[model samples]
Target: MEQIQRSNWKFNMILLGMVLLLIVSIIYSITLGSADISMKDVYQILFAKITGNNALLEGFEKGWIDIVWLIRLPRILLAVFAGIALSLSGAVMQAIVNNPLADPYILGISSGASLGATLAILLGVGISFGPNYVGISAFIGALSVSFLVLLFGSSSSRADVSRLLLVGIALSSLCSAISSIIVFAANNRNGMMTLNFWLLGSLSAANWQIVKILAPIVIVISIFFCFQSRILNLMLVGDEAAVTLGQENHIYRIVYIILAAILIGFIVYACGIIGFVGLVVPHIARLLVGVNHKRMIPITILFGGLFLLWADILSRMIIKGVEIPIGVIVSIVGAPFFLYLVIQNSGERRQ
Candidate 1:
């Protein structure tokens, strides 16, 4: 809350601490999974593999190298970026609509993306697109549906908060219903099982190929968003107020929506619908850093990465042997937190 008045040195120190903490957490997290691997061994394996020095890999078990280099690291990295992407998107979107409750779920983007992926998995919707076509299918569906939402909300070229939200809800219902119809009609038990597990979300399938693709896009978009602090702040004031400040909220809202759409598309493509990370993280960040995007975005991004990284770790060990789906873990935590946010927001409105 004191971010605006906090000294740059203090803020910078905190930021550096969070960065270092995320690094330390990543190292620690990699060592704790089913396989018995030490932090020292984790470091040696990373150094050897990353440096392409086979000689350094001499004494270690081949299975340990496979686990560290191929399995755990990419999964952890996916969780980090997915967390960052959702949190950043949620922050910007809450600003765009000037609504604290706005997120991928509320805006229907997740359902739309889910519908796309369902089609890809069941019906081979984007098979022609080659490798990772499912992700491509999801990207197309999210972008297309969000554009329609914007178009409907922006009747006569002006998008309003209420219109956007209402249309989003309607599309969410429609998309979910359509996806259900497809699943039932397909009547493929194995595919149904696949879809159910996928909808629940897991990082089990994470690989270096996905990490190589998703990490760069997320980082690039995150950097772009930091530079947009000014525009994001303007968005909170509503179009009428923003007009007086000589900013056209319509165009900016459209641009922000498209960016958010693209961001959510790729996220759903990577991790499935890990719901409530978006809804919960930004509000927590706002409480810590206040409403200033400049003050809040970096903290939001880091906090998000940390939250999901730990959540993934919890998902692994929560059960005696079998891992819990990461999405279920988040929903168990997030649903009640959302109720709290609603109550808090209402209490403020009453005052």
Candidate 2:
């Protein structure tokens, strides 16, 4: 009874922390943008909008209102959902593969999506899909490559994690070659420019319409994965042990991969191919709370959301009045941090 009560208390505390972070992040995201809006006006506008109480509203600037309410808010929400989806997928991937380095983009999903988007832009394929045809094409490509990787990776008598990694790398290289060919062949200025920006990733395109589409996909997936901590724990124990315990890791492996692929595809489509969130967030979560999935999953998602929120903010404000690609920001920071973690871990192991 004591243990159960303790667990409940811990869970409640974590939930409270998450709620506080969300509220604080929303406020910060709303108040700080390219166009400055005072916190007072920000709260008044939000309060009046929510409660229909215009008593506090008096001659506020419309431009700031539009920037905060219409533009920056949606982008921040998208970043939150994207962060959650990527980190959840990353944590689950690490469990499924039983590898510390496993991430959502490890299995060629980003490359495939990038190839699809490149094709759509350079070759004008899938133009009939509407305004966001590139995103649609990219998602289809990601899902397709993911399915192929599973099929090839599972072709052996035993589902080996090494086989999956090798197959994923090969497929990723193939997609990259194809994308390069298209870019070179097209030789069009606008197509190349569009492809470059898309590859680097951005949340500048966020809107309510995008939120409506991506929210359910990401939120539902993240919630479902949280309940899967038990299965994930078993997966970390190796396949032989899992079989002895009468738990089929292969089936769970495929399911996790498919779900991760879908979430990753949507992210790639929505924000281009932002890298390292999956790799970095899960490692940080593991370091903080050990390898236990119950604690790791939620913490990873929350940390990932916060990390990307700040990354997005910096991407916008790093060079006054100029937006930097988020991918570049993540790569710059993640590379050094990853190196430091490797050295520190190696030293500790030697010690």
**Candidate topping TM-score:** 1
User: Tens digit of lDDT per residue, candidate 2, span 1-351?
Assistant: 998898768766875687688768767877776666678888778777678776656687777667766787789999988888888887887787776655656667778888888888788889999987977888778878877776787644555666777887899889978887788788877766766766788898888888888899887888888898889999999888988999988788778877887787778877888877888988988776668788888888888888888889889888998999998998898778767766876788799
TM-score of each: 0.93, 0.87
Off by over 4 Å in 1: 1-10, 152-163
Model 1, span 1-351: residue lDDT tens: 566456566667767887999999998898888887888999899999889999999989889999999998999999999899989888988888788887877778877888898889899999999998888888777877888777786666666777887998899789878877888899988767666664787778789999899999889989988998988999887778888999887777778777777778878888877888888988988777678889789988998899899999999988868899999999998899888978987899899
**Could you tell me the lDDT of residue 336 within candidate 1?**
95
Which regions of candidate 2 deviate over 4 angstroms? Answer: 1-15, 51-58, 124-133, 151-155, 340-351
Predicted structure 1, TM vs. truth: 0.93
Model 1: residue 326 alpha-carbon error in angstroms? 0.6
User: Hey, what RMSD does candidate 1 come out at?
Assistant: 2.2
Give me the displacement of residue 92 in model 2, in angstroms.
1.4
lDDT of 1 at 337: 89
